[model samples]
Target: MPVSLWAMEPMMPLADMPAMVLTPARVSQPQSEAPASVTVIDRNLIEASGARELYEVLKLVPGMTAIKVDGNVPTVAYHGTQARDSRRMLVLLDGRSQYQPGLSRVNWNDMPVDIRDVERIEVTRGPAAAAYGANAFTAVVNIITRDPRDISKHTVSVRGGNNGILDGRAAAVGHGDNTAWRASVSRRADDGYDEPFEGETRPDRKRIETLNTEWVWESDSHNTFALQVGGSQSRLERQQESGVADIGRYTREPVQKGERAFLGLEWQHVFSATHQLKISTYGQYNKEVTDFGVCYLDPFTGQQGPGGALLFSQELRELYSQNGGDTAATFAAVPTSGPVLSRYGSLQGVAGVNFCADSELDLQEERYDLEVQDTWQINDRMRLVSGANVRHDRVSSQAYLSGTEDNVSYRLFGNLAVDVLSPLTLNLGGYWERDQINGEHFSPRGGVSWRVAPGHTLRYVYSRAVRTPDIYEDQAITNIQALDMSEPFASNPEALLGWSPSYFFITQSSPGTLKPEKIRSEEIGYYGQFRFLELDVRYFQEELTDLLSHALNPFEFEPNNEGWVKHQGTEAQLTFRPTVNHLLRLTGAHIHTHTNKKTETRIAARDSGSALWAWQLASQWGVSTAYYFANDYNDYRYERADLQIRFRHRAGPAELEWRAVIQHALNKEPIVFEENQYQEDRMWLELEMKI
Candidate 1:
């Protein structure tokens, strides 16, 4: 039977921040209703934007700040917290977690699913750890792909962008009685951008490719079986800003590669009109290898610090020496002869110690889950929906430097919704999850929506969420040079202040003791849409406890349950479709957040906000302009604003697009300047084709 026939109530397609009403009377309703802050990026929108990579399209989404720290190295900031990694947001590709086990970062290159194969992307811009598990403190992104029934033909496309970027995408679908199959593949390559910090420009090359295939079969009765397989590989070569003086004139090195493969199978069975069950299983493998030639600078003549500190200091010394002044070291070259002291002072040698650091990580994971959901209609005036899911995840990771660790995680979740009146609906959801890392949590959520008028809706929500510590948070092992020694031994500037003579110490600790973080949220909002115009507005407040942040002075990050950080914000969006071919969209947000020590009255105040305006002239032409403004809370190094513009045009299956942006658009001089790190303006462009 057709899937649509399975709906006993109206059903709305999953959307981002929408109040769309489903065709009521569907047997199996969506597990959760769309929140007012959710944003849906469908395939149509992806194609219209002419984005060549995930970062380009994701940047427009509210509450997310994306920047290229260096060519080929993109950093993500969500909810005012930025990280060199991109794992804060939970990203799911067809219900499979895209995060590396135990690590709180995401590898964008592994996200190779072609836009052509995507049906829609659902974004929930709030803590979603309750529904999606770890690394969802800020939001959730669910990428739902095209079902076999929705893709019934063969299609192919090719694309090209500035900087030698090239791409090819293809998909094919076929069907036999009661069965359907679809396959898709995408390949993309780009020369990338120049390393930003230094005067020398090095090659920024990147390549990514993916393949996915799916098979679905419907039995004569009420049963269905589906199987899916997907894999991706990427190779990148880029310059490390600090290492720009390593080899000859450029510190550029080839990042050998990163790869991932996944396989999944799902089975659904319906015993009767109001009873159904679903079973899903999947396994994944991922690997990464980086060959950064001289990736870590030797500390003999450089400041003793992490892999990064030594490089920066050496580069500076080189730059000064090249100007014909007294030179200690220069970006041009490292000295061949010098007294070298081991970080621990146990080993001593002359210069040219020749130390090379290589890192490799491998991960394997398997997951199994079962869910049962149904809607029972008591009458036209009343109905109830409920469902429950049980899932188990087993994960293991091995790294050349960090060694290996294994863990198992499990969760049980359910949701309830009821129609209390002709125009009012009430919803409640709860879940219990446990991980081998010693974190177990129970989360509950509740909300209501009322239709006060024919075209207007009002809603309010209050939810509780929890985040289990991540793998990295639980078991990460790394080596760093200690700068501030508070113990009996400490030193800097090649001088006094410690028992140890003239050096930094290597600190090590077990990472599995950190506790979980928890959050409580409260929100109330309203939305309505006129025939041609729509407006949505919302206000929300959230509080977090046991937040974990790393500190070098203390040498170890102890859970700071001693404070509660609060985030309160207002969001508004206006959209208008004057004609079938014209669209105008405006979105803006203002957030006020304060962090305080629970034991003290002191507060850290941060004010951050952003606004975006986009105009779609037609299905083939579009343009967008956006501006962001933020204030510093604790330091001047993190404060700035930016202006951005994007343009897209599609002509005969071909698309052209460009993004011109200026970070620190106001050119506000850094109040506290660090020699190697400073804010600067940049420009980016991309262009694509479909056949």
Candidate 2:
């Protein structure tokens, strides 16, 4: 019988381990000798932590901030919170890009792969454009799944808990001739938080179903081929606002439906012991539909007029005439001066002229990518990796964009690592990229690692990365339903009357093609592994320019790249094993940022830390506990503890396992910034069987 790598006992000696990392330079390298700060979360820790969500797992990593906007939507940030969508970080699942081009956000709930299938997740704490091209601005997360060879049989798992949570998963692995395959299916549903704001409805309920499969074939020892396909469908309840005049209120319940699918293929050839080549291709499709319903009150009647249609009273007509110098003719025309007026008029007509209560936004996007890479071992002391990729993205939307838009991008990157001496290694890498929307740009990175002693290493790294504007940011034609006239306006004759425009249309017209946001970073790091402890520390300073932010005007909210920021931070992680049965880990981070925009850092905490302990109580039983703390960020401050326990036993021909997890065991209500939501403690139980 072969021992599973994931079945290894916890608290292994650091001196006996050689961790391999791939995100730093797009090539496998020793974690101790990597040029940047990298963190690896393996399956053992993942199972022991008993975290159901990917974002929850990230909370344990140093310098990573994971927070739930509600129960279903989570935002993960690496350093500073510049935006809500988390566009600065690049995420990949099994080498396939997970970044959505339309919203520039990773929809964690829509990810096709199940958590149980993930073997490891590698995180790079800083810029990695030299390896991942544009949009790898602040960090990169690479999720690697278990290979088919590692799975010996079929497995099934089920989970149920509070908040109407119900989850189930099934997976199978098999081999035929020279081909190996693995397939998995998962379904999850939750009612989300039960608490509601004063005037807001209960939001964030979500349901997701996914299927994933992969096949690998070895034609010979030197050549290999793999194919992967996956898809997901998700439904989420959203919170929205609706009303007339000054007495607007939130809708009871709004819903969003999303669907995504992807297919990928790869071929690898090993020419010799020192040379290799790989080719990969992938395609992805995504679509989402959201219904935003607003209700208008008749000024004269002082009652709700209709549910889905926007009713423009006489007061609104006069207001539009007073603002734009034209009334019936201009009001009949769409507000923005763009080619999309025809479509807008056809759909909703002029806001004041035509009343459409049920307004819906439809967004669809498709992307195809092809890449080829070569790796050459020039000598025992030197190696080089070069790659080129071409990608095409197309977006079609009615709410945010005027019309269908397509963008094509190309990237070329190379990295070189040379051991100048037995104690010193030098690394250099760069990427050149061209995109239809942002034109062309170049990013470069260089670093040196010095092994000062037998178990200690020091490194210095400098890198440049870029974040390109997303489709929505570059071309948004948003129409917002503001307010309608009420009894107060009707009673006040002096106020503008007879015109009740329930909606305001805002459009952004770029002066020219926008430039990509740029960042230059410098970092120093140290790593040491002693008898019973391992430590890693890094300090970094970054200069960010051409940041994309919103510029508000009376007419519209425009996207402008006019701000700069400076960020400095330190991250450290320590691991201590007092005995083979007990392991302890501590992680902390502190960041200081100066930005031209005040709101850029409003939700970011200045410091955060976590302490985790895992103990193997018996040969078949284990328990873990963790405490997390984050300093005050405006009105938001949090300190929470979590606990988990696992029990395993072998049946006649299968393995049975039972696990329990309790999140926020302290049951404290922490204030959240900029959002009117409540947090609650939750617990879950899971049972698994393997045959």
In terms of lDDT, the best-performing candidate is 2
Q: Which 10 successive residues of model 2 have the least lDDT summed?
A: 306-315
For residue 305, model 1's alpha carbon misses the true position, in angstroms, by 19
lDDT of 1: 0.53
**What is the per-residue lDDT of model 1 for residues 505-555, given as tens digits with 9 covering 90 to 100?**
222334456667677777777666677766667788988777664431112
Question: Candidate 2, residues 340-380: lDDT per residue as tens digits?
Answer: 23322332322232122444567899999999999999999
Alpha-carbon RMSD, each predicted model: 10.3, 6.3
Question: Residue 282 CA error for candidate 2 (Å)?
Answer: 0.4
Report residue 211 deviation for candidate 1 (angstroms).
1.5
Q: After superposition, how far is residue 327 of candidate 2 from its true place, in Å?
A: 15
As a TM-score, model 1 comes out at 0.72
